[model samples]
Target: MTSTDATTSMFERIGGSDTIDLLVDRFYDRMDTLPEAKTIRAMHADDLGLIRDVLKRYLTEWTGGPKLYTPEKGHPRLRQRHFGFAIGDAERDAWMTCMRGAMEETVTNAAARQDLDKALSGLADWMRNRQ
Candidate 1:
């Protein structure tokens, strides 16, 4: 499921920190406005500033760019951290809707986008806390 190797990381393929910032910002923007994302959107705070920063750091490290997340936040026990939220198919789809659009806009590399989509889809599905 990993995309990084000795040559280049998925982070570099998609333009590193700049792309991560754009992707996270766009994702939150969609979640804040999309009707289909209402259910999941309500799970976040009115000000997305904090979460946006967190997500950028998380994605940066996840894509092998830097250790921004873990150094500050510790191991990404993502599911555990999100256990307070009730996640299911609808929530997963809504999250993916936001993410796919953000990736399309920010991650210019086609192959990198596809690979990222696949990986993130699995992560979103695994985040489900309900049936």
Candidate 2:
């Protein structure tokens, strides 16, 4: 069987948009205080409200729920959007650190966590716009 057949869609595994919303909220909370995330946090504005919603919607579509992100923000073009930032190894790691922590806190299912981790890692690497 193919990987898709073997694995559950991230939407179902993640308990849908509500769970992802919690994950994104927790991620930003950690980023707001974590020293490791300071640099990356600096890239964002003081207000995280919009970012939280954007991330939740983005994740909702990315995880196979509904295509809310595109409907609202057009194509994701994640690399293009992130290209404006100085995303080097440090920034990528910092983002991943917060996300990993959030995942650990929000996702109780081992398989779901693994799936989300793998997808996030790939997306993080893809978002790296600078060396």
Q: TM-score winner among the candidates?
A: 1
lDDT: worst 10-residue window of model 1: 1-10
User: Candidate 1 on 38-83: residue-level lDDT in tens?
Assistant: 9988999988899999999999999888899999999999999999
Q: Distance (Å) between predicted and true CA of 49, model 2?
A: 0.2
Which candidate ranks first by lDDT, i.e. highest? 1
Q: Model 2: residues >4 Å from true position, as ranges?
A: 1-7
Give the Cα-based TM-score of candidate 2 against the true structure.
0.93
Candidate 1 TM-score to native = 0.94
True lDDT of residue 117, candidate 1: 95
Model 1 stretches with alpha carbons more than 4 Å out: 1-6
What tens digits encode model 2's per-residue C-alpha lDDT throughout 36-97?
99999999989999999999999998998888899889988888888789998999999999
In candidate 2 the C-alpha lDDT for residue 35 amounts to 99
